[model samples]
Target chain A: MPLRRWSAAAAPLAGSPGTKQIVVARENWRARAQEIAAAGGRLMALWASGPAATGRPAPRTLYAAFVLPPGLLVLTMPDDLAHDEYPGIEEVFPHASRMQRALFDVSGWRSSDPDVRPWLRHAAWPADFHPLIHETAPTAAEEPRPDDYAFVRVEGEGVHEIAVGPVHAGIIEPGHFRFSVVGEKVLKLEERLGYAHKGVERRFTELPILEGHRLAARLCGDSTVTYAWAYCQALEGLAGTPIPARAAWLRALALELERAANHLGDLGALGNDAGFAFGLSQFSLLKEQLLRATHAAFGQRYLLDFVVPGGTRADLAPEGARALSDCAGHLAQQTRVLRGIYDEHAGLRDRFAGAGMVTPALAARLGLTGLVGRASGQAHDLRSDAPWAPYDELAPGKAGATEGDVAARVAVRFDELFESCRLIGRIVRDLPGGTHLAAGLPTPPEGALGIGLIEGWRGPVMIALEAGASGSIRRCHPHDPSWQNWPVLEHAIIGNIVPDFPLINKSFNLAYSGHDL
Target chain B: MWKTLRQIARTGIVTQPPPTGDGSLRLREALQADIREILGRALCIRVVDSGSCNGCELEIQALNNPVYNLEGLGIRFVASPRHADLLLVTGPVARNMDVALRRTWDAMPDPKLVLATGDCAATGGIFGETYATRGRLASVIPVDIVVPGCPPAPERILAGILAAIRASHAHPRSR
Candidate 1:
């Protein structure tokens, strides 16, 4: 209650309507996190900043955002650069350990967490040479070497290991999966990611504030709209620019389409993984049709560059809007029938029913979030919880399932798909006529902190932006909801057969590029 | 069962001829003939994401969709590099994945083609040469063909795959 009261008094950030952020003292950092956890608040993101190679001369700082009743509560705690040690929040939020390790890999600052094996550094860089620090000196080993990740072993009779990818069998992103199993039954599963790290955070500093949206858009291919809009929201907030009504509606339209497209693809893939190729064929056709329609309405098929700073890149004409609405209407009807088929399919249901079960208790303990969280009875949807701009007007419905299995996740995706389709039709029809893009604005002041949080297709996609001297980007951290979900996946797979991994994985479909970055 | 059958009947075959613009029909036939002579059966491909944003992977995955019908065209994405004739690599070669990429290329049999799809694969795209990224996949491995786009469309990727297969011939089409 004190944490809420404290955060409530803090200055409000733009775009995040109900959210408040404040700098907390180092002594109160761990205590605050415990308070958040006790109050049933989920940690949205955890990141760190030490001495950087360029422009800024800020001290080592630890930052975290918590989702509470009054929206997101952002906290900042600074540590001295010299010994570089800070309190860890992993005990409070179990998902914080990997994040802390990742931040340490990037910034050379250590967390109090016991597990210190590198998360993002795969021995590509020197183990001691941190990339995010200014005063970092290369300590050892020049040539890049293969990382020998230490996977926790399950030593017992008949217990063996099944080591899968960074290079998976599928046409998907890279991340290594270690399965400690007895025969076909899995005893333990640990994921070693960061193979997809392209130094995105470090690359953020090199970009200008205006051009940051481009890189943000590419943070994750599937959630391009979300990341772009969040980045732009942060930028616009920093610059004190108010976007036109039409652009806001346009953004919502794009977001819904993105949600629908990804859901369609995942549902189809889930079916294929469960040995029902018919679902794959049908959903693939629907998704393809939707993408083509999207391209015709907007410029791009995947909507990679449609969202820009201040607003959208262009306006949707009446005809284009009608076309998109028509497409959505058609998709809505087709998917409704398909959903019925999926529900009635006995064999598919058998495969999906109990596979990869994550009970509500386990989900809450592990800090599960996004659509996956909703499947496990975590009633949190940012569109409903923290409605911003068009979402406030649109007030989209939330869909949830409490079963917390592959079936539950499938059911949630289906419900969301239909909701998104409905939203698309509503947005296009009720779009206010006005200028889409805002006039070119002035740069935000140096040291200004801007936070933008949007409910992406996956979950809440947040961009923490800080302005540098002369409109340079000091640091930009884009956080995906996958960070909270990926750890829960390991829990979800316990006691399940090896073959069902794909089906469960497709059901969750957490972002590798976004999380690993 | 009847409902499922009816749904299938309602949605007949959505697959159609792709728009690859390979000049005349004779040229297309000639290319297919060359592919048949070099490789007796379907062309097998292995897609490796060095460090892409998963944008190119989406389009590449779409190649198997009913519209593009990549498998129907005598091309299939296989699990292992050993079975693949063409290695489809995407994204800027992240430093971490460099060794893995090399091992994948090494695993493939002789007379193989490496098609670096997307601008990132071709020239490291937006996340260019940096400490963490060794830009342009060729810095890590030999690139045979480059399909340029932020992410080239599914149709374009299909065209690139076909071209890679035809170009995979030993003693050479260029010669």
Candidate 2:
């Protein structure tokens, strides 16, 4: 497990087994982070919590979670606005740069990192105003100002820049891409996201703890089931509510369906990007059929807001289960045939192989998780690695490839799609018999904290929930896997041509709204 | 390619029946007729996502799939708004995307109709007007028609687009 000895100061936080909340002094926090990094620990999530609810003028705490195999280790340190700065872990973890910037923008806690550029804050509000601070009201509205984000320049001969959009030609989410290119080859690529930031974190504080799952479901529409399940898992963990076996199985079913639908859609899109329009038509047809089956089973095509706290909002009826099983069987056969076509297509292979390669070393350094990580030879799946409930029993296979190119990612997706179909069949076949929803959700004691981590179709979606008095949420941070993978996209696009940017970008397919929120 | 052709021959056409002679047929026909009357042939549409969850975008994308085959109805999505006759906008207007959305609306040629798709575009949905959001599509620009659902179905979005075209024809000065 590569577990290291904790210093005497960090001894108090090592109390519990599954998840532990530890407080570290500001002085020792950086040293602890460095030690964890040295011990092969990956930075899972880092965010600043809002002010304490007791109104005792306490310093706002900065929390950083590290993945230590079977469990998560969360370290916290107080950040006083008077001092207004904390040690930056970007030196230890490079990806922490943007996360630290986001924390500073939202919570007024600055990091010592040299890159002090605004991340989520794009001059929509005044520079002084921090949205997460309780003093800053949600009603404050400033006149829209034009934002001039500084893109790190790559100056030399023939280093011309091409700027893309916060709004694109396709009906996808909004994000800007700046490519420094010499002719067709890209010298560097910088992505400016957060155009879809809807103040979801602040909105979470406004909603009741029970109702926050709905908002979580909308955090990223494509991975609604995964997000909602993670949120529910966190809420249930905090409340000490035990979900029924049947409900857990149903959640797994919905999640696997979501995975299958997205994979089908992406497979088609990737093929289309590679200039195979026939694949697009066929795969889109299959995806549509899968979505129809999902609608028949869950009453919603996308299964948005279906998984709520305590348990799921609805259960799969017998007929729905039968329909899902039938669809899975049919999709399995059809996808197998299509997979053969995709593999044999020489043109597709040529475009996909050896393009947008992110070497395994770079992937490990960047701490890329989920399917993208798997494609690049980093095999870490929460279902297998940190199993809970249904997955603990199912024992799903983890897909990977050493090639680490666009083709490897596509192969991983195909492998995952087939595996997800099998998991769905297993879930349906051994469907438990019980009440789908928990009887009642008990409110957790005030100041209680719980973490929910679930492997979404994209990757691990983590939700950290802090319960307030009388069923209110003090703070909730839904960390999407996109946070780690988005930066990898910039690295992956370095040597690729400007034309292949979209193809490479689609291979990673990181969520803009998910990260923005 | 030959295998693909053989598979196509075996499958034949799998497109669903057009919205005609059913409960939604009248609405669909009226919309198609109005769009035809205004443009004289195909309706050129441009989709703008002001700030959405991409749930609505998925449904919008579905309209192009074989089953829906939206292009067969003489409605096609154009790359640029300058060539588009209709602008289909989704999501609440995020403050960051406010300028881009307005620019997109401005870029569309004259006689353009705007359709706000989904509950968020209609009334900002769950992510209401906040520090980062401008609320509904109407708050940012003029919306001729609205399709309201968490994410309105593809058929409903098609209806909304048609209605917007119809409204544009009725007003004539909306563009």
Best by lDDT: 1
Q: What digit string (tens of lDDT, one per residue) describes model 2 on residues B1-175? A: 6666765676578787544212231223443454446675357888887778888999999998998887876779888888888888888888878878888888887776677888898899899988888888888787666788877777777766555443333322122
Candidate 2 lDDT for residue A226 = 91
The residue pairs that clash in candidate 2, if any, are: none
Query: lDDT by residue for model 2 over A1-517, one digit each (tens)?
Result: 1235453333312111256667887888788888888877889899888673222233478999888677678898876456557899998888899999998887788889999999998867777777677555445454466678999999999899999988787778899999999999999999999898888888887788899999998888899999899888888887877789988998999999999999999999999999998788888898888888888887888888888766778888888888888989988988887888888899999999999999999999998889999999989998988888888899999999978999999999999999999998899999899888888888877677788888999998888888877888888898999999999999999888998988998899889888998
Global CA lDDT of candidate 2, please? Answer: 0.82
Worst 10 residues of 1 chain A by lDDT: A134-143
Off by more than 4 A, model 1: A80-83, A135-143, B21-37, B167-175
Task: Show where candidate 2 strays beyond 4 Å.
Answer: A1-3, A7-17, A52-58, A80-82, A134-143, B20-36, B166-175
Mark the 10 consecutive residues where model 1 chain B has the least summed lDDT: B166-175
Candidate 1 residue-wise lDDT, A151-206, digit = tens = 88899999999889889899999999999998898899999999888988888888
Task: Give residue A87's error in model 1 in angstroms.
Answer: 0.8
How accurate locally is residue A165 in candidate 2, as Cα lDDT from 0 to 100?
88
lDDT of each: 0.86, 0.82
